[model samples]
Target chain A: MIGLRALATGDALPQVKPEVMRMYNMRFCPFAQRTRMVLLYKEIPHEVVNVNLRRKPKWLFERNPFGLVPVLEYNNEIVYESSICDDYLDELYVERPLYPKDPHRKAHCRVVMAKYDKMVPSFYKLIKPDENLRLQAKETISEEMKSLEIELGDGAFFGGPQPNMIDFHVYPWFERLTALKSIVEFDILQENNLHRLQLWQKRIEKLTCVKETMQPKEWHLEFFIGLANKNPQYDIGLPQSKV
Target chain B: MIGLRALATGDALPQVKPEVMRMYNMRFCPFAQRTRMVLLYKEIPHEVVNVNLRRKPKWLFERNPFGLVPVLEYNNEIVYESSICDDYLDELYVERPLYPKDPHRKAHCRVVMAKYDKMVPSFYKLIKPDENLRLQAKETISEEMKSLEIELGDGAFFGGPQPNMIDFHVYPWFERLTALKSIVEFDILQENNLHRLQLWQKRIEKLTCVKETMQPKEWHLEFFIGLANKNPQYDIGLPQSKV
Candidate 1:
């Protein structure tokens, strides 16, 4: 334990050079993927422990009372909220910056983050079908995609010239739409004027860093498709790999 | 906007000279209120602008694409995400610091913050009058309340001996439970393990700072009651303060 005084005055970000952060995570969680994306971007080496939500590791329960994953364990500084972890990493590592340095740009970045978080709850509603939520998700995805189109405009990634923290934070979830396009029906790309979104998706996944960090796992994609297809009301089209 | 370099290098905390933060807020939003609670706790003052969500101010919309209340504009820095704003203020403000200085305690603080953000979505589902959802809300709320109790166990606030950022973040939403108790059939206060939770709620509210920053207005409570009434499937009893 240290006071603000104990922390080195000249140094910012966590100055204590410790081993790589011990990451508590799983492959399927997009939230966890967001953190992993940061690690890949920062080039921060860390031990990754995958946990089965069904039978969570005891250490997980000990470290995380809430019983959730994607917890980062550094020397002593542990951070939560995948996006917060991303921000913290950006602060600590300046070599490859992710967040925008402008306030309006930062707030714009948050809107994209909000778009991703908003998708989860309604998206889960489709795990079991009901007209209102299915219709609601359709409308939301449509509007969100449209919003993303304008937000992205002519930008290569969500970030203008290069992928930044916002790109890594939101792109993985959008990748799910690509994987399960056929399983759920919505003209999100169409209605949202987001043809650019699909293009950007391809660009992000093909990044040398991103490609090095990951490979296509057909099972995970298939699983979401299976989940989407199980519902009676959804007539999501067959899978489309825009990427 | 300040660079990550400026953000880290600033002798922000514990320095007598305070950094001013401009806050766009709404008194009634539990999310927005969390920021005010932290500002008051840290003893930092800022210019506050009230935003109407339905009719969002153009400045806010232009400034914050998400346009959510409690947008903190500091030293040419614009930070969104309520939890971000809370932690940022603590990091930047010079007096009455509310964050735990210890790394482990900081991790624990984040665990609690992450839990709050994660639980909020599901809990919002409770407003809809669906049998499964209502049950889930109660179950989820009860579960979180239990966690809060253990976290607070014989301690005053989330950070022992002080009502830190997470405590302020959680309390305003839990206060809504008080309003909902009037409508829902469950007695969260009377539950077996919630006795400590009930005690903590009262203890935190007694803080002069919290009391000043948050108060239950008759209509706002009615607004929540009205929100709860949106789902008509289940029977609810709303005690109308004005009528």
Candidate 2:
């Protein structure tokens, strides 16, 4: 129930209740998924308004000038950027805090997220048409994975006992690891005997919040491969009329 | 006295007191200047350990694996990244909060920072050796300036009455704007008649914290231009001792 569906061009905007929150999202966007995971994990009362990114509505632009998902609208105020949205929500609804209560630990959490962020470009590079660039990106990804292994360093989660911002922030990239391996002929996660990283991935996969929000491996592979090939109709066949 | 000078390969590391803080910094790094400004703003007693970036010390790498400057060592715990360090310090010393108290306003402040964050690459593009790329960057910067002008929109500061994280986060770029303009023959601030932005620049420049931390405009111009020219001796003139 927490996962994505589709949106079409002619679909009417969802009715917003005074108490409920709404998020403008794309079905296949990893950035949007990060917010979705946070919302579902917190069990917040929210509606997802999936936008057909290929034909984004004018209202979507009105909501977020950058036209990015998942922009959260709460109490008639809108906020965007996945990290910012998540941070705002965590601060507003502080029951199960996504960040550490200790200031030093929280600061260290941000550094961990930043360290993982360096690998993002290489993940995108896996889909490029240039094989040379793809190979170079593979090397970069491998190097970055080694760094991640060191950071993990026998920990169950980057969030320590439970998943926090760092866990959720970086998990989206791993969701596509299967697709990246299939398309690029190698998997950085599998290669270096990254024992801690592999175990960390498994731990993330077993989480109920992740289970509800994540699409299957095949689904991710197909979706991303379609994106890599620049396919236009890749997101069709969902219940568009309802979304 | 909270400003930068030069450091050389053999410079001795500043002796750290039992309780005082120490910051590893570079004379001309805009990123490092951000943390320096924050330290000065908060009136925190800290010693500056100038790192000869051309020849970073082994201890520097031990402090931070990424070997970046603006590393803060407080209570024997090391923290790096300008924003993270500033946020940690602000949270630790709560007398003057860097972000707004209201969640909505804080989120808006983050968006303001993110918007300015997108313009950074274009600023660097002004220094690109390729004329066509430089021209393209100029256009991008102009467009981004129009966006900033819209964001500022009659406010004294991005956070309303006073400067906040957004102001400090984006001010370092303006500190080097004169250099960027002198080298590129264009001024994004002056070109669009960005009155608010220009006023904001003057206001930030006048802040005692900024005044204490900022290098002379001529110094910034010479250093950045030297960097753009790939000059290795730009950071020379300090005693070549053990850092």
Candidate 3:
């Protein structure tokens, strides 16, 4: 029986000395990336099988009755849900912690993560070149950034100088700010005056482990287009994008 | 310091004493009602604050940063996020276990819950009454329910004869099936030979404590209609005329 545990988003998990611990996920899926971030951060050595989410590999459906990504299989046990996977990582490898020890801070970080997962991505999906929607996306995106900036105000990142679990959980979605700006002509990235967020992004990007697990840029754009096109089962960023 | 612990969803949570743990939630909000069901099954003494979806209480925002209901304030500690609140409840109280004893089973429950939370609700929201969308919702709802029925095949509920963490997590949304039959006329609850699900609903509803915590029927219907209208946060399940 695997013991219960907790780990946050992007902490490199230490590679367990080779026992069949594998992660079933897709490269472009943000939820998968949550677990991937933990794996790379923990330096946990495991097999990575990318599932064709649209076609959904048979084994994945077999392993996961729910048929979602970021399904982590450790030994004979499988833990799914990106947040739960983060929890498993925390329990599996205790050396380096990503989630905070403080309860209030932890709750707040998760709330922000949940907000990003539930609401922010809609700006990326529902925004169109329509004159009104474009402005709406920009304003919404900027507002979110401003609020998040206030939350991260004096800190270098979400959790002080170092990127904590909340930072790891949200950074990928925040990257979509650039995507939103590029596609929607909404310069929310610059308008929010998200000084710390910008620096934090650069800092996180420089992390070798995160870079190792980062998805291809085009894959994301392609996936988003599919989701926007009304493709069923191709949900990448729809509300439940994160764990 | 709160010690790290785990428990099943429907299990009795740790108690500071009688009536101190009050939860503000409703039966319609998939997230909110999930914890409500757990509290009832766990036999915890809790005051249910029924917030009007349209006119949410001012105190809810103070307890919740996002102003969403389903906030759990106990012993001067506040935890938000419906699932997290449920988990926190289980964490604090372990007499009745909501989380599974096995890590693997727990993982399965989490994914199933995540799928309902993310996939089911997101799909439900995007659906409009247009011919194309209605048809699409039909197919989508079918696939969703069929998948869930298979998950629940031969089980009394999601986890077994007695309701478990996953059941409380997933049931509330599917319970929408009941309202959906009246409003849009879907077949999961009506057809599909899902004898188990209907029975499951009765069993869940029959719980003395569970039935007591539910919100007013008129409010529920209005809320679903509002969700369909996108006027309020969720669909309150009233007739479309009210909408």
> A1-243 in candidate 1: lDDT tens per residue?
111111122323332345667676655667878888888778877766555554455556656666676777777666766766666667666777886775456655765676567766765554345778777777766666676677778989777797887788776666666555555655467556567887887788888656644424454555565555752211122234310
Best by lDDT: 2
Q: How are the candidates ranked when ordered by lDDT, highest leading?
A: 2, 3, 1
Please identify which of the two predictions, 2 or 3, would achieve the higher lDDT against the true structure.
2
Q: If you assessed candidate 2 against the hidden native complex, which CAPRI class would it receive?
A: medium
Clashes of each: 6, 4, 35
Clashing pairs in 2: B10-B241, B10-B242, B11-B241, B11-B242
Candidate 1, residues B1-243: lDDT per residue as tens digits?
A: 121111111123221122556777765678888888887777776656555454455667655667677787766656777876776666566477777665456556766777767778776776677889888877877777777777787877667787777788788877777766656756765774577778788898888768876555454556666556652111112234411
What would the per-residue lDDT of candidate 2 be over residues B11-56, giving only the tens digit for each residue? 5566666487888888778788888888888888888877667776
- The local lDDT score (0 to 100) that residue B201 gets in candidate 1 is 83
Q: List, for all models, the DockQ compared with the true complex.
A: 0.15, 0.67, 0.25
Q: By summed lDDT, which 10 consecutive residues of candidate 2 chain A come out lowest?
A: A1-10
Cα lDDT tens digits, model 2, A81-100, are: 99889999888888778998
Instruction: Give lDDT tens digits, candidate 3, residues A127-220.
Output: 5546677566556666777778778877876778766777778777755555544555545556666777787777788887678765545556
TM-scores of all candidate predictions against the true structure: 0.65, 0.88, 0.70
How well is each residue in B16-134 modelled by candidate 3, as lDDT tens digits? Answer: 43337877665466788778777777777676554555555556666675767687776676778888778767756667788777656776677677666555644474346577876
